[model samples]
Target: MELPEWHGPTDDAELDAIERKAFADSAALQLHLSNKSRIHDGVILEQEATEGAKSNQNHIALKDNGCGEFHRLRTRRLPDWSLLKRSCNEHRTKVKYPAIKFGGQIVYSRTALEAEKATNELLRLIKSNTHAHSGNEPFPMGLDIEWKPTFRRGERPRKAAVIQICVSRSHCFVMHIIHSGIPPLLRSLLEDNSFVKVGVGITNDATKMFKDHNINIGALEELSSLANLKLGGTAINWGLGSLTESLTSMELEKPYKIRCGNWEVNVLSKEQLLYAATDAYVSWYLHQILKRIPENSCGDEKPNQANAIA
Candidate 1:
């Protein structure tokens, strides 16, 4: 499990300015510790690594991973993300939220040729749609990925099995990449920076794409970052289901069975197709709503931190 990276002031000048402002305002910086013992130990080790000379010891040095995150190479332990996983699972319950469905046509492509044609059609829509963008603006598309679930411990997860993209409410393309290897044309489109892929935690999807298919997806716009910037509140992390509801007052229903179903199957069931299509459509639709919101419009609100099933 990957934790979100932290960005802090870089130089002493900026730090001094922050301290001066805090003193002038009679405010003190507050640090909240969720796990005191673990954090304290990690911090102590990190300080030692920075101040002490290199030693020929078998113990791994606690080093910063550029996000103020400390990691020991040989004694590393993966963080437990079950709580986050459970929060995501709760969003998928149909009983908790109303169902959100896409009325658009879902084009399922299983072969390399079919995927190429579908991708061409999607590109054509992006090129011709003046309503969505203007000169020199990136065409935004909702993107999501799915793979077969692995329950085995210490086993690497399977590669991405399905790639879903939607440029508008009228059409969505679900490419069964497990069956049809990523074709040259599809790779080209993904690598193109002109078309921006928008979704929650989309950077993770980009990483998975590179690891699995050797394809470097470019022009990614993370929905959470966009929301934090555009919504003009105390910056908060977001989840797809929660963000959709916040913007549109519409529930983005994600059924647990369909969401966790086998995406690598030869043929996707209607429920699976609808689930995939809706996820992409909601992402696109939410971006359309969020982009129009004027900055500093009293949009500040408590954030919903439920993890999106990306």
Candidate 2:
């Protein structure tokens, strides 16, 4: 018999149905095994059990027979993710804490001239922001990238469409790179060793940028790694939104629709612009906050203070 191919059922009802079927199949199999154990010859059953135990020694067959079924069940039993998302929203609504907002002048560039100007402006900001004594220390610029997401099976990933960079609390630049190819000045700024691009999973972002634009990013600072080094207790992987909330006690309003929207559009909507800007701004702001915390301070001990993003 041919195994069923998964087409990525994402809806709650479909997930529920799949989970029910998997459970029923497991129950039936268990009942069949119990009946066979009672009716079959003991010697034959023992031999079969011994063979099954031996199969565990073969990684390939073990994965095929054991881990495969385990993953299928685990995948099928996934919780209603939509419900969890709704609950998070509801929690924010109940708490009445304001969502993270960007208080900055946003520059959206779609032409080479505009991109170059933005790049120059970013360099100026870096110059003004860094101290003279901080020579050769890469100025941390909050960075993020977005692309048109693919939902269809076997679809090739679209090249990155947007690149956002925030240098100060008052300014952010969003480049529609998919429209305006990375210009020489913009490329130089990205490759400049004096600036450190900061974000979550920035290595992956750098890799994707290099793949799509052939422009290699220079220095990168992963916020998770920074947080691990600064904060006390066991280290944990940190996502941008979660880290923001952990540090600032504010929701980073990431509406699913806007987040997963088409970044390749000719002009971004107001919501998308804000979303992009706020992400970069928060990254920069969080870095400042983490930097202020002493190296030996336990984050859990000063929850009240740590939660406040100056």
Best by TM-score: 2
Question: lDDT per prediction?
Answer: 0.63, 0.64
Which stretch of 10 consecutive residues in model 2 shows the poorest summed lDDT? Answer: 74-83
In candidate 2, position 164 carries an lDDT of 93
Clashes of each: 0, 0
Q: How accurate is candidate 2 locally (lDDT)?
A: 0.64
| Alpha-carbon lDDT of model 1 | 0.63
Model 1 — which ten-residue stretch has the worst lDDT?
76-85
What TM value does model 1 have? 0.65
